[model samples]
Every structure is written in structure tokens, then in C-alpha cells.
Target: MIEALIVGAGVSGLSCGIRLREAGIAAQIWARDMPARSTSSVAAAVWYPYKAYPEHLVIGWARTTYDELMVLRHDPASGIHVRNGHEIFPWQVDEPWWSGAVPSYRRITPAELPAGYRDGYVFEAPVIEMPIYLDYLRQRFEALGGTIEPRTLASLDQALGASDLVVHCSGLGARLLAADSTVFPIRGQIVRVTQVALDTFVLDDYGPSGMAYIVPRSSDCILGGTADEGMEDMAPDLSTAEAIQARCRALEPRLGAAVVLEHKVGLRPGRPTVRLEREQLAGGKLLIHNYGHGGAGVTLSWGCAADVARLIAQA
Candidate 1:
């Protein structure tokens, strides 16, 4: 029997384990921390690709993930909801390269444009409540005869002794494990506040103040964030949190009175492009590398996992 070891417990790693198990491979996940503590948990996690590149490939993965997410949205336990939102821009531009990925997408009307924004587009995409979604994934993976062990690897080579194959879903940890210099951190911070009356997500990437977005969940809403590239600080900066609130409040003043809940910071694994290729290890075992989705880790999760399964099958 073929056995596999996935090296991270984040959305990417869990999704990979589920796919591999579904393919009848004996798969287990090994992580340094629990899924809830992963950087994935800190994401606004909307099913839209942000800061990931190489148009053609990204769109295919994003589109596949979008279809899957829409299906998951119907299952309340999945913690995915198809939410309507607008992506406002400071100036008019060409239709987004990945616009076709979403089920519904259109230009915003003059009245719909927010104050000070030149143009915008409205679309309905899955907004994942990370905590609930991660828990759902963990449960689903375990139910599929998958196991998760909390073990940190000093190097990628360490997993070779335990399994016939290794799937690297280590996110930023890949920088050290894979010795990939292109992998770096895009530090992001978000503020979770008590729920307001807002039902829609607002993403204003070109706001004068910086990139700001509001993602409303059932119990609370996530307001974010900063995209400080190469920043390794995991601790939340109070000033950045306040600035995020100010920007989000500018989008919807109703957020003014929302009580502060918590702040989170995560290092998004920023890379020029995602790496999802296979390699042969020194000891005759197989290794599939699937890291560097950046902010699209959740957006591209399922598609990447499916691809990894395909690669393994062909091997």
C-alpha cells in the first residue's frame, strides 16, 4: 500500500490529505501546530485570488476551487457562504484576468461606487469563516481514515523515513525546508469585531489608506489588513489594527460601534507563482511540493490538492 505524509496542517495540507485518502492512498498529516493556529486561520479567506500570479494556471485552479466552494456553501457545516461583495478600484481598468472564475461578476454602477473610488465590480464568492472551516476540514479528514500527528520536521528529508511519499504543504516553512529563496512572507493583520448589520464583503485594494476589506461572518466580522512584504513579525501591531478599523469604517460607518474582539497576524507565503511539482528524493521516495499560494491558499486549496493527487497517480 502506498503511504503519504503531508507536512502541514493548514488548509492546503488538510485538503491534500483528504484528496489523497479519497484516492485510496494511506495518508496522514504531520504539522508543527494545530490547524487553528496555522496562518490559514488568520486569513479573510474569501474565494478570490489575491497576489497570486501567472494568469492562465491561476484561473483554472481558482475556477475549480470556486465551483467546489459553491458546493460546500450549501452544507452549513462546511462554513462556506456565497456572499456578495464589491472589489473597488481607484481607477478604471480592464476586466480582471480571473473575472471568469466567479459565478456572478459585473461592473458596479455609478451609485454603487463608494466615495473616492473610480470604479468597481460586484461578485458573489464564497466567504469562508476560517475557524469553522478549518475545524470542518479537520473532522472531514479524520473521518476519511486520515490521521494528523503534531510533529515538527527539522528538514524535509526527515519525512522520507516514515512514508513512501511526502507532500510538502508547509507554507512559509517551505522557505527553510525546500531551500526555495523565492518564498517570502507577506505579513497580514486583521481585526475581528462583533458582528454588525453588514451582509456584504467589501474589498478596496486601492484605497488611499491602504488595502482594506470587510468580511462578515455569522457571529463576527473580519476587518483587514496590511500587505507588508518580507515582514516576519507574527505579533499583532496595535497601530496597524487601528488603521485597519479606520479604513474599514470608512467603507461602512456602521462598523463604528462594533466591539473589538481580537487581532491576528499571519505571514502569507508570497511567491512569484505557486510551486506544485514533483521531485524524486535521494532515498528513492517521491516528494510533491505544493506551497506558495499566498493569499489564495484557501482560494486554490482544492484544485491544488486534486492536482497533487494526479501527480502521485501518474508517478
Candidate 2:
């Protein structure tokens, strides 16, 4: 009967908690903020593998997570919606590197391309409403008899003696707590608007204007975003929000009349590559590092969690 303490209550920590508990380990989470307040809540979390590194491993983790999300979509309470979407490119391109992960991936014909786009691929991907989905995860983790508490730690050593194992899913907090200076912030800003009768999502990662995407949920459409590398400011910039809305509206004219609902800014935990390995400290305790997901935190959550559980089993 091994007990584990996971630091961070965001999607990664919650997902790891669920997997560990299902594997018969007693897992509890401690974090500075709840799911709703964590950076994961601010993501325009459509399942596209963007901004994580070490391409091969990221694709593997993304594929596993895509399948998991697809299964979760069957449960109405999971807040996972499989929406038809296309990622358009400004120039001609071949099939995406992650196309195999998508069950229904296909290249769209020229007739389906938006003006000025030369190539695109369409697929059914999960568009998650973070607020609802985070709550769903929290509830699911709790129903498994796992506990989450509000706590702030000055260092990773603080969690060492409380449990047999400590898993770090602390996101950006890892930069300081784990003393891993490679971790930095990739700031993103997004705008939420009324749904505007849109069903499909549109993503233009390499558009001339910047990284523009429209992710429509059941109630609101999430329009974004900017990937400003090395930016840590969390305050939503009014000009940036306006630019995001403008770019989204250019891509989808129907959004022109959509009223603004809210503006959000989040600092994504960025690193050269995701850190998902284990370390042994003094006193025979185990510490597993699982942060620095950058913009793919939600995209990589389940896959990373499964790997974490496997590591625990082998311990």
C-alpha cells in the first residue's frame, strides 16, 4: 500500500492522481491553486500537439492522449467534444506528422480551403471546455477516494517525508521548486465569445498574422491566441485580445458580431523538452518529474499520467 503525494492540482496532477489511484495507490494532491485557477483552465484546449518538444516522444504521448480523450468523449459528463476541424497552411504541405494519430484524418480539397490557404487537413479532434473538463477531472479523482488540498511549497524537499512517493506536476512552479532553470513561460492570451452558431474549429498555426485558432465549445467559442515565448506577464493585454478577435473574425466572418465574454491570459510552462523522468533522493524516497508541458499540457495529460503510473509500478 504505497501512498503518493502529487504536487499540482491542474490537469496533469489530477490525471496522474486518477491513474495512480486506479492502480491501487493512495494518491493525494497538494497545490497552490485549484483546477479552476490553474493555467490549464485558460487553455483553448483543442487536441493539437503544439509547442512541446522531442518530436517522437510528443507524438507518441499525443496519440495515446487522443485515444483516451476520444473514449472519455462518450461520457457526456466528461466535457469532451469531438469536433470536426481543419489545420490550414499558407503553403502546400504533406500530411501532418501526427496524422496517423487521428482516426479520421484526411487532406481537404482546394474547394474546402479558406481564402488564401493553399493546403489543409481535416480531422475529428477533441475540443475540451477547460472549465467544465477540469471540474470533471477533479470530481473523477475525488470519486476514486483521492484527496486534493491547497498548499504552497517553497521547495520539492518539503513534500519528501510526507509520502512514499512524490510526483511533481507543478507546471511553471517547477522552475523554482525543482531548481530546473530550463523551465520558462510561454505566455498565451485568449478571448471567449458567444458560440455564434459555429460547429467546426479552425487553426492556422503558421498564418502570417500569428498563431490564430478558433475552438468552439457548447456554450462559448474560444478565440486565440498568441504564443509569446519567454513572456511571464499574466495580465491580459487589451490590444492583444483585440488582435486575437480580429484575426479569428478574419478567418470566420460569423464571429464578427459575436459579443466578447471574457479575456484570459496564462503562462504556459515551457522547456526545451518535456521533463517526464524519475529521480531518487536521500532516504529511499522517489520523485518523478512531470512538468514543462508548454502549450500541450491538456494534450499530453492522460498519456503522461499513464507513464507516471507505469513508473510507480516498476519502483
Candidate 3:
């Protein structure tokens, strides 16, 4: 089997490892901390195909990941669910954003909208509990005889010498590791409440300058948060947390009672466009660059992985 070394163990790294195994390639992921210990866990894992990606792949990637997770939903081992919900708001239904792709995706007739919502559409999409989902990917990787190495790499050259190929799934780490000044960090903050009710998801475009949303996971209610802002360090900012909660509480009542299980944060490795390029290194190392999904990492994970793996195969 062809052996590959994958750097950075986020969803991209994990998903890429899983796909490589399916293609009969042996893959190992090396990271300072495991995938779940960081950004992958902080996401309110919404699989929405939004403006975050190019039209050719954005919606299509979310659609493909949804289909794959559905087949596994029946298996108790698979920690995924088909979460049905709506993208809601008041005064913003003009030129509705979620009209075409999701099933039963029609606007609630005037009589159907809740009192507070001016109007909105109900649509069904898969919401993943990222904690379990991350673990599941790790299991699938090992089941296929893949390896995961957990360590803080001081240099990319360390892995460069031993492997036939190196995939940088390092997320924000690439800013230094690959000398990629293009990859800066978008800070996202979220509150996981030990509180939840209701079976679906809620997205309120009302960002206080507000793009607020609430996603339910099995253990904790994942409520969030967003940004169009970039910060250099990967630290959670308090004012940002307050702003997200204030918006979310105004939108959803249950989460309003939120007893914080954890206030989590992550630096989403962001670029104007996601880079899925391949490079031959200074010493002739084969590198597949697959970072920069911004906030849509889970939504685009597997599909992006397929593209990354295809490029690596050709390289």
C-alpha cells in the first residue's frame, strides 16, 4: 500500500485520512493535539452550503457529505443525525437565501410563520455532533489500518524526509509551517450549554452586525457565533463571546437559559479562497495543501478531501 503522512489532525486531516484508506492507501496523521481538541470541536457543525466557497464546490460538497452521513446514521456506531430546521429571520425574507437546494425547501406560507419571524423557510439538512463525528472518523481510519501520531512538530522538514507525500491539514499552523502569509486566522467563539430542547437547528441572519445561529448536539447545545474578522492569535475573546450570546439569546429561548458547559474558541484558517494546491518542495517533497475552509470545514470536509486526494494522486 502507498503510505502517506498527513499533517494537522483537524476534520480535513481526518476526512482525508478516511478517504485515503478507502482508496487502499495507508495514511497516518501527525498533530500536536488530536483533532477534537481544537477547532473541529468548537464548531456548531452546520452543514449549510453558504457563500463561503466557490459555486462549483460549495453546495455540492455539503450535499455529498450529507449523503454519506445518511447511510451511516442507522448504525449506532455512527454518530450522525438528519436534523431538520429552518433558516429564520424577520424583515429579511426578501430574496430568501435558502430557497433552492434543501428538500421541502419552501417558504412557510404567511399563515405558517411564528409570530416573531417575519417569514422563513423550513428545510431539512444534516447537523453533525462534531465530537462524536470526529471520533467516528478516527475509528474508520484505524479500522482501515491507518495510524495517528500525536506530537508537536517543530518543523515540516521532520516529516518531509520520511514520507513520499505530505498533506498540510494544519489549519492555522500553516501560517508558519508553510510560510503561508495568505493563511491568517478568523476567530470564532461558541458556547456549549448543558442545556437544550427542540430537535432542530436555528439560524438567524440577524448578526448584530449579526450572523447568529444555534445548533443542537447530543451532549451540549452548540450555540454560536461567527465572524468576518481575523485575529493573529488563537485566543477566545470575551467581548466576542458576549456578542454572540446576546444575539443567540434574542433568537432562541432555550439557549437563553444557557448554563455554559464550555466557552470554546478556534482560529479558522482562512483565505479569500480555500487553497487545494499541490507543490514540490525545496528538496523535492510532494505536498498537498488543503487548509482554509474558514467556517465551513465540517460542511465541506469529505468533498474537499476527495479533491485533495485526487490532486495528491496526480502529483
Give lDDT per model, in order.
0.91, 0.91, 0.74
Off by over 4 Å in 3: 90-101, 110-119, 232-243, 256-258, 281-284
lDDT accuracy of residue 171 in candidate 2: 97
Per-residue lDDT tens digits for candidate 2, residues 1-315, read 237999999999999999998988889999999999999999978998888988888888899999999999999998999999989998999877888788898998899887889999989999998999999999999999998899899998788868769999999999889999999889899999998899999999888788799999998999999988889888899999998988898899999989999999999999999999988777789999999888999999999999999887787
Pairs of colliding residues, candidate 3: 206-210, 207-210, 207-211
* Cα lDDT of model 3 by residue, 126-187, tens digit: 77777887888888888899888786776787777668788888887887787888777777
Q: At residue 182, what lDDT does model 1 achieve?
A: 98
How would you encode candidate 1's per-residue C-alpha lDDT over 1-315 as one tens digit per residue? 337999999999999999988899889999998999999999887988998877788898899899998888888899888789999998987898889988699998879877888888999999999999999999999999998889988888788778879999999999888999999999999999999888999998889989999999888999999999999998999998999999999999999999999999999999999999999767678999999998999999999998999999998
Better of 1 and 3 by lDDT: 1
**Residue 28 displacement in candidate 3 (angstroms):** 1.0
TM accuracy, model 1: 0.98
Provide TM-scores for the models: 0.98, 0.98, 0.87
Better of 1 and 3 by TM-score: 1
User: Which of candidates 2 and 3 reaches a greater TM-score?
Assistant: 2
C-alpha positional error of residue 244 in candidate 2 after TM-score superposition, expressed in Å: 0.9
